[model samples]
Target: NKARMSAAGIVGFALEAAPRTTRAQSMDVLSSQANIAGYKAVLVAAHHYQRFMPMLMTAAGTVKAARVLILGAGVAGLQAIATAKRLGAVIEASDVRPAVKEQIESLGGKFLDVPFVTDEEREIAQGVGGYARPMPPDWMRRQAELVHERAKAADIVITTALIPGRQAPVLLKEETVKAMKPGSVVVDLAAAQGGNCPLTVADEVVERHGVTLIGHTNLAGMVAADASALYARNVLDFLKLIIDKEGKLAIDMKDDIVAACLMTKSREPELTS
Candidate 1:
């Protein structure tokens, strides 16, 4: 920002983006916002879906619970599993992180096991600080195949996978979507970042292949007050670590948090004595 606009640049995302560190967890805006998004996604899907999430034995007879498949077992994915469980949906989830299997199970969600676990796949999957890096083309092909079968059987699908600085990876292809049952729902939480489904249109719900794809951006908006409160508190907490006692902007480059947040400075430092 110091170049064109001639302004100092320090981004809030410096403390909030992916590849989470333990010390920065309290200040992670991504997780805070994602928690809200995940829960809201399930609710949104339930609203649009033609079926019920929980089984009911009434005068109308028995109703089977909806099948939910959540892609990307990150904080959002985990929360989605938990929320769906609370809603009584039979849930399954998939992610590149091997660690996510345990996480999904802990949330009472079944893990969809993809048979593409090679040494190379494992190495790449163990990305920076438990995040997922891009896998090989062969691995992606296998993942797509697995998703096709699972997505076809799902009544509600929520996709949360995303790659940093790149467009969100497409997990569900158009053909796979076409194969989904009529009246099914797919919520793409990564819609603003180019979506996890090829058919997603950012910030809009579209009907295609007899299914509803919810690609609404900023899903945290559904719970705006709570989401904003959590995100603001995180930003404030991170700012406290960097701001000097005098109250003037004094960035300590020696501090990792400061160094990480600053994108530009006014000018080069004056020579030291």
Candidate 2:
């Protein structure tokens, strides 16, 4: 008998597959979600400030455009840059990966470049797929200094640097936040992973040296129902590939990607008569 025909009915199965999507693919979805958060974060920040986002050429006087700084040119950061730019804010962004410079520029955001030499072999080995490699302490210090310098000049800063399964690297120190203009806002997207800013406390807004540090956790979960639906669909699509037509579990262990990502311990042992 064929594998599918012999096997008994299986109601459901789970696999630990790394969502089968590239950075580009994930970015497509993340951009949509982050755009909402980006726009909302700006609006939330604006409410706390005395000025407006758009310049007013009214009878009173000319209002200046808000200076918006985005740290880490990842999907969320790029979306934040674009959203802030559209809202009539001058957007500036920075990233450890120099490759993101063009991406930021394409979205009408200025990319702040910080010079650093990367080891090619080390970069390649540490980089799994398209993800960035972890940097040494020396490189991190240089990057932090550059971010601190630029952050002081901006009225608003949104940080989005994050690494999967690791603590988010600190990009903005407390000293830098203190130097920011009074009433300035910092939204740290890495709050759940210890934040990119020193003052960030997940899900709470705190004031430090006259600057508002927002460390809201699960920015995606802010729009819970929508996020849940999208994530569920992604999971369902991946599962379809592993289940047979009869709906019995048939994992192909020889497949490296499947083997590497699947969580075997989570599954209950099959009870057969």
Give the best candidate by TM-score.
1
lDDT by candidate, in order shown: 0.84, 0.71
lDDT of 1 by residue, 114-169 (tens): 76557988888877765689989998898889999999999999999987778899
Candidate 1, poorest ten consecutive residues by summed lDDT: 4-13
Give every collision pair in model 2.
Answer: none
Per residue, candidate 2 scores C-alpha lDDT tens digits across 115-231 of 656675346324444445567777778777877888888888988877767899888898898888898988988888899887998999999999988887767777778777766
Q: What is the TM-score of each candidate against the true structure?
A: 0.92, 0.80
Provide the lDDT at 218 for model 2: 64
Q: Give the TM-score of candidate 1.
A: 0.92
Q: Please identify model 1 stretches exceeding 4 Å from their true place.
A: 5-14, 17-19, 268-273
